[model samples]
Target: MNEQLQSITGVILAGGQSRRMGRNKATLTVQQQSLLEIMLNKLRSVFQHVVLSGSQAAAYHTGLPVIDDFFPGCGPLAGIHAALKLCAGRGVFVIGCDMPLVPPELIRYICNCSNFDLVVPRVGDYLEPLCAFYHRSCLPFIEQALNQGRYKITSFFPRVRARYLTAEEISRFAPPDRAFFNINTPADWDRFCALYPDLKA
Candidate 1:
C-alpha cells in the first residue's frame, strides 16, 4: 500500500457547468481561498502528483497539469476517464470541486489503500463517486459506458474490483459530518455559511 501511495496521483474533477451556482464553482471562494486551491493544497500534502481535470487551466493556479475532459458534457465519468488516461500511474484519487469541506485526513486514508480498483465512500445511501479512488484499468469500462451514452459514475462499478466505504467507515474519517459537504446550489452555500460562520468571515 505504501508503494502504491508513492505512485498514486490526485485528480480534481472541476469541469462541471455550475448552472445552480450561476457561476463556475471552481472559482467560488470559501474562506478567501477557492475550493480548487483548498483541494490542491490538501492533495499536495499527500500525493506525489496532483492534476486538475477541468476546462479552465488558469483558474487552477496550482502549477500542476490541467486535464480537460475528453468528452465534454458527459459529466464526472468523462473526468474520471481523462484522469486515468493522463495520469502517470494506475491508481488515482479523485475529488470534486464543490467539495470544499473535504477532510484532508480522509484523502490521506484513501491514498493508503490501493489494492482495490476503486475505493468509494457512501454518504447515507448515496455513493460519493465523485470523491473516490479509481484505477486506470477501469478506463475501458468507462469509455464503453460513455460510448453507450451512460454518463453515470456508478455505471461501471459492477465490472470493477470496488470497495465501498460505508457511512460507518466514512464517519470514522469524517466524524461529526464535515466530510462530504459539497456545495451545489446557492442555498447550500448559504447553509455552509450558517454552519461555519468563521469560514465566511
Candidate 2:
C-alpha cells in the first residue's frame, strides 16, 4: 500500500434495500466467501482503517465499525455523508458492496488522484460515484444537496473540485465492462458466476 493511501479510510456502503436481488447482497457468496468479505479484504489490504456503512446487524457479522445513515432513506448520499463524518478529516474510499469485481488497482489509482474534493471514474458517459474517493471537504456540499432533496450522488459535483478518471485510464486496471460490474439482481449474480466459475471453488 502506498503511504498516502494508508491515511485514507475505506468505507463499504452496504445500506441498499436490495429489492431487485430479494436478499442481502452482502451475504451472497463468491468462492465460498461472502461479497462483504471479499470487499472488506480488498479494502483492508489498501487501507488501515476500514469501516462498513450499513445496519447494526451487518456490523455484528463483519466485526468492523459500522455506521448507519445520518439521513435514513435518502439513498447513497446519506451513506456518503455518514462515512465522511465518521472519518473526521481523513479521506474515504467509498464503494458499493454489490460491486464484487471492483479492482483494487483502480481504487489505488483513484486515491492517487486525491488532489480534488472528489475523485470519481468517468467510464464512458457514466460517472461511477459509488466507486470513488471523497475528501472531508465535500461534506458541506453533500449536506447542502441532501437538505434540498437532491439525492443524486453527483448533484454536489459542481460545488466541489472534482476529478474524473477517463475510460482509457480505467482500462489499464480492468476492462471497462468488468471493472464496475455490480450484482443488482439474481440474473446478474448468475451471470457473474458463469463468467468466473472458479469462484465457486
Candidate 3:
C-alpha cells in the first residue's frame, strides 16, 4: 500500500527537555502563538491525522492526541517508535516542535516521497532526521536498535531504503538552513528573532 491507502500520520516531537533553551521551547512564541501551536498548524495543513509525540498530554491542550513514548528515555527514536506503531501499517511525517520556521510545503514534499523506507533531508553534511518520513517497514530496524540500546535516530538508516533530499531540492520551498532551523538555546532564539525581526511575540 502507498501513503494514501493508510495515510501518513503527522507527528510533532514535543518531548524534549529543552535544557539549553532553559525553558520549554515548545511554549516559546512568535506572533503571539506558541512554537507548538505553529508546528501543529503546519502539520494540520498537510495531514489528516496529526498528533504530538510527548508524554505530558496534560500540559498541551491543542485538541490533538499526544502519543507517549513507548521506549521512554530512548530520545527521539522513541518518539519515532511510538509514531510507527500509531500509523497502523503506513509511515509517519515527523518534525521537531522547536522548528517553528519549517514550511508546510517542505513537509508536503517529504510526505510525497512514498517510495523510500526512510525519507530525510540533508543540509550540507547534517541529516534532518526530525523533519523526515519513516515507513512501517522500518519498524523492525528501529525496534532492534532501541532494544539493543542504540538510541541514535540514524542507527538503522543503513538497513532501510533511505532517501535524503538534497539542500538544492529543499531550496525550492525555503532556504535549507532556514527551513530546518531549530531553537535549542537562548542564543539561537535571538538569532531567530534577528532573522525575522518583524515577527512579534
Models ranked on lDDT:
2, 3, 1
Write the residue-wise lDDT of candidate 3 on 14-88 in tens digits: 988988999998998877888888888888878888888978644888788889888987899999999998765
How many Å off is the CA of 17 in candidate 3? 0.8
User: Residue-wise lDDT of candidate 2 within 75-172, one digit each (tens)?
Assistant: 89999999998785458999998887778888888998998999999877799999999999999998898999999999999889999999999999
Off by over 4 Å in 2: 56-60, 199-201
Candidate models: Cα lDDT each = 0.79, 0.86, 0.85
Task: Tell me the spans in candidate 3 whose CA falls farther than 4 Å from its real position.
Answer: 1-6, 199-201
lDDT against true structure, model 1: 0.79
Give model 1 RMSD, 1 decimal. Answer: 2.2
Q: Model 1: which residue pairs collide?
A: none
Model 1: lowest-lDDT 10 consecutive positions: 169-178
The lDDT of model 2 is: 0.86
Q: Is candidate 1 or candidate 2 better by lDDT?
A: 2
